[model samples]
Target: MASEGLHAPRERLTEKTLNLHHAIVSLTEELDAVDWYRQRADDCDDAQLKAILLHNMREEMEHAVMVLEWLRRNDTDFAGMLKEYLYTEGDIAHHED
Candidate 1:
């Protein structure tokens, strides 16, 4: 598939950068899918179809989280930020300070 959202020329990007781009794009798509599936589930009148849509939404959420973890593993800044903010119980915005 053609690179739809690239800001720079394809040939200019390094392999690592390209891979990061792919992950970022995939994450975006996964999040979009999650939103779409949840909305469909919310709107559906049929019980079985709603269940299926909710299940698909959860799957999409899983995909999004996997991609996010990949980003944290690959990018030091992401790793640092995630460490600072994730899984903590406090005033989140104030926790940064």
Candidate 2:
């Protein structure tokens, strides 16, 4: 079945492409949830509720990173980009040089 995000027909997409699409969508949703939770936590007046929201947000971040790692493992381009930009101490823009 084709997800709503697909521009082309499902039949036209390769198996690897479909899988990648799923991973990308999952990552996006996880990140979106993280953002929503953070925003809610910031706006909430109750300290307990805010703490719960913050914890949930961290869980979503973990999910997002897992999906991102899957993408890095499956796609060489992402692997290269992550390797170059991630965990670096110097100016990120300098990596482009």
Candidate 3:
């Protein structure tokens, strides 16, 4: 006989894991944009604009860390987190106006 009680929790865990993966992908894209903008901000001579950009970039970093924490909680691999950072750096070089 099947222990029906185990199935519901297992299903819920699977769903949660899928949701975490989705969040990770979406956050990675945002991190890319943040990198592009940060370089532009650094190049700007205006202090006010630089401050704003720096604030936004810091926020993006914070967000990435939050998503990473969520992924870690769910046993998601951390192997690619640094890869994402490196990719964002490359993006800064290629996409800067």
Best by lDDT: 2
lDDT: worst 10-residue window of model 3:
1-10
Q: Give lDDT: candidate 1, residue 8.
A: 94
> In model 2, how large is the Cα lDDT of residue 55?
98
Off by over 4 Å in 2: none
Q: Give the Cα-based TM-score of candidate 3 against the true structure.
A: 0.56
Task: Please give the lDDT score at residue 95 for candidate 3.
Answer: 51
By summed lDDT, the worst window of 10 consecutive residues in model 2 runs over 1-10
Tens-place lDDT per residue, model 3, 1-97, is 2222232455556766557557767578679868977997979999999998888888888887787666666653554544445456446555544
* Tens digit per residue, CA lDDT, model 2, 7-34: 7888999998899999999999999999
Q: List the residue pairs that clash in candidate 3.
A: none
* Residue lDDT tens for model 1, 26-81: 99999999999999999999999999999999999999999999999998988999
If ranked by TM-score, best first, what sequence of candidates would result?
Answer: 2, 1, 3
Off by over 4 Å in 1: none
lDDT score, candidate 3:
0.68
**Per-model CA lDDT versus the true structure:** 0.93, 0.94, 0.68
TM-score of 2: 0.92
Against the true structure, what is every candidate's RMSD?
Answer: 1.2, 1.3, 10.8
